[model samples]
Target: MANSEPGLADFTKHLRKWFETRQLSSETDYSEKLWIDIHTLFQVLAKGIDSTNPFSEAVCEPDNPAWTLRSHAAEFKVCQRIVNIFLFMDGLHYVNNGDWQQRYIFNNEQRLEEYLRCMLGHVALLQLYGDNCDHIELVRTVSNSMDPFREAFRHADISKTCANMNYRNIQIGTKLIGLTMARWMEQLKGTRHVGSITSDKPVQICNQGQGTNTKEATADGVRQNGHMPIVEMMEDGTTDVVKKLIKKGKDMTDEVKKRLIETVKDSTNPEKTMEDILDTVSKCTAPGNACVQSALESVHTSVTPVPPNPADHDPSAISASA
Candidate 1:
């Protein structure tokens, strides 16, 4: 069955009516800092239905019990509704830059913080005692809704040193308890992490720390070994050369290829071997190929002579010779 619960709009209207009845104004500056009557609000929440109390009737059922031992689920829903009311108030205060007429609703920063912490404690208790998945889901939803209030309270002031200490303790205790309860639930459901087994291997428990250690070892080994073998280093180099040759081959125009072949055929040295032609082609195609350039220079020096140029002679001597 669909939940017939009151949504945010219903809660907002109810809260606004309550504020209006109490003559709370967002514009009022209560510098004297009168404490917001939180107990009165609780009493209003507890009150069931009456023609005189329209807000209560609109927000909750006619016979709704605020604190009930009969049904934990019912009580949890009540608490959730209450928390939502506070969340709405907090949002209003935030959006208006703390200028809401209901700003006086919280007597001071400390009061507001205490109120938020109290609600958080209530929600945590509900979560601890929750019986079913639906109850747990409601608890989670309420917790999420109240997160902003908790964050705001974190930065709020505490008037007394002891109050501040107690607040911090409460916050820590609630977190630890929530986590412990969740872990207990996981274990109860047998949903906690378990080791895995493969066909050939024994059961191996997955450990994040172990994985991290393995990664560290690999990184440290690489750092310690400054260089790899020449052959291993040249693996990527050879791959790059093949890729570059393929790309150049694809992009080489038919005209360009013909011109290269003609140049090779018209070589001055008739005895120039196929190897020499290939070396020259490599150098011409890839001027940045260091290996090809070195090889060609070595071959040229070994096979070819350095011819004397007449231009290298003194100009006057060349003229007289002529």
Candidate 2:
């Protein structure tokens, strides 16, 4: 077995270390970019299947007799591999960010074994096609493209971490296409609204015209006047993580706002100096009032509050008083 070979084992170990270094480095944008490559690889395999469909008449044009063989190779090669690879990389990314060694991998020995077996089975299928389909160009290309990924899966041994995932309360499978498909669909949902407004926020109506429309009754009938269309407010867009962070800090935010407005308005001092105003405003907003007193006192003394002009008062106030 290749697993028993010391040379291959040493190479795999070095490869893992290299992967770890790249994963940990700030300069490397690996996960998302690698995912895109995985997507392209799946597309290549799918296109291969369609191009080499055995039952389709389209394959007759310069096609070989091994169309069915190539189709089978493409289908099996792409069916569960793409999702499993994504699950593997994403789960490893998740686990590597925290201390979940015992929980995700080491504790589940039997599951790990099953995961490895399934991955090896897929890799073996690839190797078989590579050896037997030398005459088929599409299979050759597919096999060559998948070779590195197949080796990564064979040597990484993180299948169990991916196989039994409880992401979003749904169990993922490494061998089946349905369950893994559902998993990615659910994961994609969290990012679906990125750079878009949230749907739950209610639309705000705005009046766009200068005056309100009026209806008048004429001698024969009632006439209605037309008004401008209402404009809607833009909704706030945010991610799930940003939403959680905002929710967690909401109470603190409200408390700080309340303290700030109260500090600004709570001044009852009869003195009309800038120091007096700053001192009052800083009492609740500043930490340890004694520390900021010198800074407050040194502030420009020329800026004083101007008395409210009586003419600027609303006409409703004068009418109410009368």
Candidate 3:
């Protein structure tokens, strides 16, 4: 049966209360934030649904919970529906800026750095509904890209007298790094995207760091999913996307650094920005075999340039004679 009444999204707030009352977690800040983000995304989608198309009719709600989203058109729709909710919530400012890096969600003083860290990490959870965990890697890779931003937070001069939020906020930094765990697992599921980039160019890669350490040796690097998609298999792999997006007029900034780092963090909370992310990216050295732009550029240049010919000798010309 369809949820005819469309149970109010207040479900998020109530869920948090339930967790809190049982002392499962002290306060439901993380869970409540998810509710807020999902609800916000739903409202946005709801408007589009009412004005143009009804989602309920197009997207089926299957009774099977174990089925992968790819199993059926309806399942994927529902999965994408849930993913869209999170994307809309997290995208409020960056989406408006026309570039992912322009928004400074975390740099301001007088902020809840740790709480925001938790929230960013929680956003990764949005992958749970998908047929692909590549999104998990996508999220983690995005988080790693924002490491420099978190590093900025870690090294940022907080007041000596700033009150502690009951524990050392180092949790935020570790939490940001912990995003790689999801990335590793996400890679197991893999990802795929279809687009055109023959005319695309690589955005100029810059060293935003004044020089700082964000985390211990880890796999993620400065390039958020914005710069490069993780575990890709392109004609040139991650290098191609970076080159294309850059050519498309993408800009780089410290805030972009922050968002990239945050992307790898958890998706438990949908709206919060973690400061340690800036600091972490600033500090951590590239993990084993990590591919930064410079590396990609080197490989791109080393490939023997193919001469243009009218023969069209590759697979395109493979007719019945093949």
RMSD of each: 34.4, 28.0, 24.4
Question: Candidate 2: lDDT over CA atoms?
Answer: 0.27
lDDT per residue, candidate 1, 301-320, as tens digits? 22334244453211111100
Candidate 2 weakest lDDT stretch, 10 residues: 226-235
Residue-level lDDT for 3 in candidate 3: 15
Candidate lDDT values, in order: 0.30, 0.27, 0.28
lDDT of 2 by residue, 1-322 (tens): 0233343344334333333444332212433332343344333323223221211222232233544545454433332233333233223221332222212222223343333323332322222121121212232233233334436444343432222221111111111121223223333324421112112222111111424321111101111211000000011111122222223323334444333223322223212332343334333333433223333344334333534435321111110000
How many backbone collisions does model 2 have?
0
Which whole-number lDDT from 0 to 100 does residue 12 have in model 1? 27
Worst 10 residues of 1 by lDDT: 313-322
Model 3 regions lying over 4 Å from their true place:
1-71, 91-322
Model 1 stretches with alpha carbons more than 4 Å out = 1-38, 44-131, 145-322
* Residue-level lDDT tens digits of model 3 in 258-322: 43433422223211222223223223345312222222222211122334445322111110000
TM-score of each: 0.21, 0.18, 0.20
Model 1 error, position 143 (Å): 3.1
Over the full model, what C-alpha lDDT does candidate 3 score relative to the true structure?
0.28
Counted clashes in each candidate structure: 4, 0, 49
